[model samples]
Target chain A: MTFDWGFVGEAMPDLLTGLRYTVQATVLGYAVALVVGLLVAIVRRGAPPLVAGTVHWVMEFIRCTPLLVQLFFVFYVLPGVGIELSPLTAGVIGLGLHYAAYTAEVYRSGMEGVPRGQWEATRALSLPAHRVWLAVILPQAIRRVIPALGNYLIAMFKDTPLLFAITVPELLFEANQLGGQYFKYLETMTVVGLLFVVVSVPSAIAIRLLERRYAAV
Target chain B: MNFFVDALPLYLNGARYTLLITVGGCALAFAIAMAVGILGSTRSAALRALASVYVEVFRGVAALVLMFWLFYAMPLLTGYRLEPVFAAILALGLNIGAYGAENVRGAIKAVPRSQYEATVALNLSWTQRMRLVVLPQAWAQMLPTFGNLVIELMKGSAVVSLIAVSDITFVAQQLRTFTGETVLAFAAALVTYFVIAQVFVALMRLAERSANRRLGRIPARPRRRAKPAGAAAKGGAA
Candidate 1:
């Protein structure tokens, strides 16, 4: 029941190490999600019907299943297929691919939000496909969905703790280690929970503001 | 194939337990959500502040942290350890309840102002106004978002398997350990989970339809009208 200020001060350095992993994995994983998700959205938009349909079902499958299960499959199962990865690599890939399904939907909806007249203008001007996407459609589309993307980024940040299950030494995992080693979870868990709250609550409010700002646009 | 046949009972039993936890968690979450949401929406600032703190704390941390805090930390602090399944249910209920509160609050607020005016004009009591007018409309508004949160609760219950809860995911892990059949173990669990998601989806749709029917939105038969293409943003993002 006692709050251990001394122990918390001592544990700060190790906790920061865990926080570093959290932020690094979030950045790397979100980068992967953005790129792969865009590719998925593009393929789903313009690929042949059968390919697009198959991709849709695959995306649905990914969306429906739990990320924890997917993480386990990646870390434990993939090794059997001779595709073994270190824990961090597997964690990033699992988090990235899981969110990619979500981001792809965000991107597709954003693209669909682009005005039909803009597509017509590109066609009338005989613009190349890549050029239309790069020069016109993508700019408006990306701007419109930036807030949605930001929300997913925050979500990915929170979920980085699930990496602990795969033995990644992220923040929550560090708290678990500290608690187990010293038998002092009160400080470790409370501090980590506060750290999460401090970071996440403000980011969430910013995203809402962003959404409102874009709604006016 | 023979291995899968041999392991069928393990997967089935695992799925049964998973469903049990999900059901237990959803029921608990629904009760908490209703209480917190109505409390937070009321005129009393003290009640609202308390409810808001619960929602914020639950929503702030990820489910893993909350679960670990309860299962591992709470006992040290309070000398009362939760059984693992109860811990899973409490954590899942609290986590999902936070999101559900937003859904309930938003739905209540979204109810037409005219309805409240009508309640006032009729001199209905507060309880009468809520029971006769506000709640029905708000309840209808709540169904879809509530459905999404229910699916989320089911998915989140998988995390309890990490605490050795023998959930479908745990069964898959155990099968992988015993038989070293990675693909079969995971794929089985994956399919079962997908089915659960679909079940929620279908049930929610049915609930939505019935609510609409009750409220006179549709007469009897359902018709599909193309919505003027806005992105389907399923709520409960946090």
Candidate 2:
């Protein structure tokens, strides 16, 4: 019932392994979100009305529902349709796809913040569309939104514990397993919470600095 | 399809629990937000420090981790066991309340300096100044963010299922295992959550309109195409 330092010492190595998976999932999942989110933002803006509207609603639907349920669906249901994914694959996709709906909005805002003069200048020069987007638009837009994107990175880091549900052996999952095995939840769960705080608090401060730097520009 | 029919009552029951947690968590979160947020804006350095510490610590921890700690670890530490549903609500309230506190503090600070001066000139007590002069204006500014937080809390309520609470997600999982109709089970749950979220959105919009009207300001026309710029800053560490 009391807090146990020795038990925490015993749990450290396993919990560290869990922390590694948590970090890995967060990085891999965020990478997917960044690329997929940019594509979603572009298509929503420039594609045909039917395609854009469909994409828009799909993102809205994804945003409204819970990520936990979406994770469950991706992990359990997709296999029925012959798209089997390992737990880590499913967890990464669920995190990426859910956050993509969010990051796409960030991209849209960043793009919208670009001055109309910039778009007009590209048109005046008669640049090809691909060149315009890649050479001019994306760099400016992405630069301004880096801070906002960093915020989501920390948010995703906090969310990595949800991967436990799919048996992903992440930090919280390891803690829960240890707690059940030892009948001592205090040490393991406290360590897990502290680990999250250790990572996220510093990241948040850094993102706020980025926000200030970008806002000045 | 047969599974849907057989599971209708269970789904409804689960949906009821989801609604309960959403409502309960929001009430608790709002109370904490107001208290901590006001404390944060106060002149007292100690109170502000206390508010900052609460916000930072709670916001930094994941809601699931907090929930597990409350449900599993609290009993060992304090020897007082919490009911599963109460533990879920408490953890979620504490987590989301931290974000809400920022919104509340920002909204309060956004009130013009002249208003505080006016209250001072009128010899208003602190409570009168806050209640009569300040909160009415700040309440309007806080609505849009509060709406987002409410939806986040509802989404977060899904984590209660992990602790064996029979919320809609839990029911969906059960139905999936019971009938092997994974898609239908989860799709139903997703749609239920979507409907609840949209309803909350509509309500918040209505509240915002009313709040604006009370301030004698005209309501802006609803846009058809793009969302407002604020939508971009939606996610917090909930």
Query: Residue A169 deviation, candidate 2, in Å?
Result: 0.4
Each prediction's DockQ? 0.52, 0.63
Tens digits of lDDT, candidate 1, B175-237 = 889888888889999998999888877787789888887888884555332111111212234
Per-residue error (Å), model 2, residue A168: 0.2
CA lDDT of each prediction against the hidden true structure: 0.84, 0.89
For model 1, what fraction of the real interface contacts is kept?
A: 0.57
State, as a TM-score between 0 and 1, how close model 2 is to the true structure: 0.97
What is the interface root-mean-square deviation of candidate 2? 2.7
What TM-score does candidate 1 reach? 0.94
Model 2 Cα lDDT, one tens digit per residue, A30-80: 999999999999999899999999999899888888899999999998898
Question: Candidate 2: how many backbone clashes?
Answer: 0
Give per-residue CA lDDT, model 2, range B1-238, as digits (tens).
6877888899899989999999999999999999999999999999999998898888899889999999999899998999999999999899889999988988999999999999999999999999998999999899888888888889989999999999999999898888888899999999999999889888988898899889888857763434422232245542
